[model samples]
Target: MIDRVWTTNEKFKKRSEQNIVARSSLPWNHSCGSKSFAATMSTKAEIPHFVDFFKESHWSKKKDDWLDHKCMEKHVELENLRTMCSQPDAIPMSQEEMSISVLGKKSGYLRGYGVGRKPSNTNTTSRENDGEMIILREELSSLKELNETQQNQLVRQQQQLEAQNEQIAIQQRTLEKFQAALLRCRLLSSDQCGDDSLEGC
Candidate 1:
């Protein structure tokens, strides 16, 4: 789900950079070149929007330094988006759709450097931060479900123990009754309570 709050640079200052390479990975998969990548997403999301997230300018980076390399080229904006951003004072973009493990360190280095490089924040955004938060949030939800399961198991075990204890109490009472009958029979003499009279005793 896309969020307007995330569309703002407030949530992703670094992502809002001018030079991004993976802009084509935007959920609104516009570029035909990214068809294979778009295939990995929902078909409904592939309907291209009027604007792309990172403005692409064709450029090159130094070898090894190719990661996170920046271009001096001026950033071009979508005429409509530029108008909206100017009036609202915010960049209009979709929420990042990628997920990363939130429990670990963030990784935002390029191979992601800019040519026409708009800092891209898409499903392809650095998984360490925004995506990681999503993954971690899901993990938190799962943990809560597991906790509920454990609690239910404990309750069932308690019930079983209670049932067992009740049965034990009944057995104890039966044993005491049998012992009392034998004791009463012992108090009788041989003539007072012979073998046949023992039944009546």
Candidate 2:
């Protein structure tokens, strides 16, 4: 937006240097009287359309921004200039002087875009987009590594649980074997005691 407005203003200034209004007759330069009358026109007569010619020729796409603060501010400046030019004691100002007085502002314009500041042209916007893409790719790579680490941790935990289960199974089998041997020992002791009682009888 800013770039467009700046380009337009620059074009207008070049046009002014190469004979103003781009041509003798423009959409905004229609005189109230004939060409002969324009030759002898007074400052009062020209004041009404003082800023219209340049504005109409160079405004950006957003024409409705004519009511914006910056536009209004410049309009006021131009209006004051026109009024001053109509005064009896007013001195004639050069083109450069007129621009400095009315359009010398650091930034802002009729189309609500920056006028004299650094322009956000195509190259600048492209560079910004490239930077954003690089950052996004870095973030995505970081996330992928984190997911792989979590998966590895889960696999290690599962292996540990399986090993613990095998150990418990071995312990249960050993306990069952010891219980069988103890039962056999008790049977043998009972048999021995019966035989001794018979012998005594």
Candidate 3:
């Protein structure tokens, strides 16, 4: 849904950029009715059909959703009818069933087959379904890309952690060597104090 909105917004922006509404209107030039010079049109006014197009899209979706809901209701009704007819207490339907009967050809066909068909434009539903499929595929691709990016980030962090660990080990070994050297120097100094200590005693 967000992708659809963003794409629609981008198309609106492009239409505005192309200045499709006005063939020869210059952007910087504007004229007021001789009273106010401050009433210049903003760039938004350049796209004349933007609002209408958006509204039409909204209405189209609403209408389609309504039809879809009605169709689904019919399907549910048919299913219920079928289930009720299957019960032993229910009367058996004739070969030429009533219009409301689940086994009736007309009801079944309309409830099931009519879902993908549009009377005004046969290709509209097909195109819409294809577009939705494309969008889903694109979303999946984007998620995969994001996952790959995170994996790369994790690998880099691991490398950095390993490098830091190696540096810490080097620092610890140097500290151990310095402590040993200090201890050896103190022992040598103590050994050299023998003559002075005897004189004092």
Candidate 4:
């Protein structure tokens, strides 16, 4: 929700600069300043972790941008964590708690930037990437379940068509039998009468 574009030269320049103004237009059932935010989340929640991450100084975008691309990506990841923590959806640890969490987790990246270093691999640094992958896999599994249900419905429809065709065949056979019986009755009456004309019999 915060829209302020951060800069490298002044990380945490002031409390105001560090603050990312949330999207203001959205109606807040829960205000950020209310005491109710504290009551909703667990003490061990990631809100604190997120707050800490931002406090560690944002990555500079210019002269000191020598950190690894993965680390930069990590920075973005940390920011996303912040958004998840302090945004309207992220309740309880609105300010301090959310900021601390992000800063704490990415402290290593900030240090590496100071010494002109980058993360060797961004994908495996923490369990965060793994967690995201797991979520995606779960979504795919749900989609697979939906597809299987559709296939079963299609099979049931085909079976119903087969059953209907069988019923039609039986009806045709019954009609033929009735017609044959009627023809035999007419022949017997005519033969028994021994009339010159079949119409008189």
Worst ten in a row by lDDT for model 1? 96-105
TM-score of each: 0.32, 0.34, 0.35, 0.32
Model 4: per-residue Cα lDDT at residue 103: 35
Question: lDDT tens digits, residues 67-180, model 4?
Answer: 345445545755676565455422223232232454343442332122222222332243346666567657766776887899999999999999999999999999999999
- Which is the winner by lDDT between candidate 1 and candidate 3? 3
lDDT of 1 by residue, 115-148 (tens): 2223334523544466675676577667768878
Report lDDT per candidate: 0.42, 0.53, 0.47, 0.47
Query: What is the number of backbone collisions in each predicted candidate, taken in the order shown?
Result: 14, 0, 0, 25
Q: Rank candidates by TM-score, best first.
A: 3, 2, 1, 4
Model 4 / residue 152 / CA error / Å? 1.9
In model 2, what are the clashing residue pairs, if there are any?
none
Give the distance in Å from residue 23's predicted Cα in candidate 1 to where it truly belongs: 38
In order of lDDT, best first, we have: 2, 4, 3, 1
Model 1 segments beyond 4 Å from truth? 1-128, 189-201
lDDT, model 4, position 8: 36
lDDT of 3: 0.47
